[model samples]
Structures are given as structure tokens and as C-alpha cells.
Target: MIDPEELGRALRATLAGFKVPRNIEIVDDLPRDDNGKIAKHRIRAHYADAGARTA
Candidate 1:
């Protein structure tokens, strides 16, 4: 399995600090809309509290 921390380290090494994500979540599937597009609102709402805590 890919290690999220290791991936984060690699990204930090190669990308600008502002371009790196503050959080990493691994899921089986993302919530999708009826049209099969990613449900961005749902994702944001779901992770809202987590983001708040981190911030």
C-alpha cells in the first residue's frame, strides 16, 4: 500500500509548499452526483470539521 506520509514527503520535496495538501484521505470511492461528476459540496461538508480542527 502507498504510504500517505511518504507520499506527502515526496510531494513536499518536489512541489511548492502552498501546492501541498494539508490533509490526505483514502477512501474506496468518492461520493458522486447523478451525472457521475464528483460531489464536491458533499466532500467539503464531510471534511469541514476535520479541516477546522486542523486549522
Candidate 2:
């Protein structure tokens, strides 16, 4: 299984060009719809709320 923590750490380590967002949440599995499609909007909302809370 892919370790989310390790994945996040690696991403943060190698992400040199882009400005990584402050609240980088490493979810085990991304939110999905009934059809198994990834719910990007929900993920965006989740991070938005998380950013708000941290702010």
C-alpha cells in the first residue's frame, strides 16, 4: 500500500519549482463519488476549509 505520509514527505522534498500549499493533507484515499470517480470538488472544499481553520 502506498504510504501517504511518506508520499507527502517525498513530494515536499522534491517539489522545487512549485509553491506547495501550506496545509498539505495526506489522505489515505481521496474522496470519491458513487461511481468510484474521484471527487475533486470535495477535496478542494476540504482543503479550503482546512486552510480557513488554520488561518
Candidate 3:
């Protein structure tokens, strides 16, 4: 299995600081659109809902 922390560490080592992401979320699957493309909007909304719940 892939380790998110290790992946983050590797990214930090190889990428410019500003280019690295601040958060990482591993999921079983990504939401897809009718055309089978990744549904980024749904992903954003899902995370937004999660953040709101926590706050």
C-alpha cells in the first residue's frame, strides 16, 4: 500500500515548497462524471461539507 506521509515527504524533497499540496486524502474511489472524468466539483463539495461539519 502507498503511504501518504511518505509520498508527502518525497514530494517535499523533490518539489518546490509552493508547489506541494497542504493536505492529502486517500480514498477508495473518486467520483466520476457521466463522461467518466473525475468529478472535481463533487470532490470539492464533499470536502467542503466535511470541513463545515468539523467547524
Q: Top lDDT: which candidate number?
A: 3
* Rank by lDDT (best first): 3, 1, 2
Top candidate (TM-score): 3
Candidate 3, 1-55: lDDT as tens digits = 6888998999999999999989887888999999999999998998899999999
Give candidate 1's total backbone clashes. 0
Residue 15 lDDT in candidate 2: 87
Pairs that collide in candidate 3 are none
- The estimated TM-scores of all candidates read 0.74, 0.54, 0.78
Query: Model 3, residue 41: what's the lDDT?
Result: 100
Residue 47, candidate 3: C-alpha displacement in angstroms: 0.9
TM-score of 1: 0.74
The lDDT of each candidate is: 0.90, 0.75, 0.92
Candidate closer to the true structure by lDDT (higher is better), 1 or 2? 1
* For model 2, the run of ten residues with the poorest summed lDDT: 17-26
> Mind giving the per-residue lDDT tens digits that candidate 2 earns over 1-55?
6666676678788886365554355557888999999999998897799889989
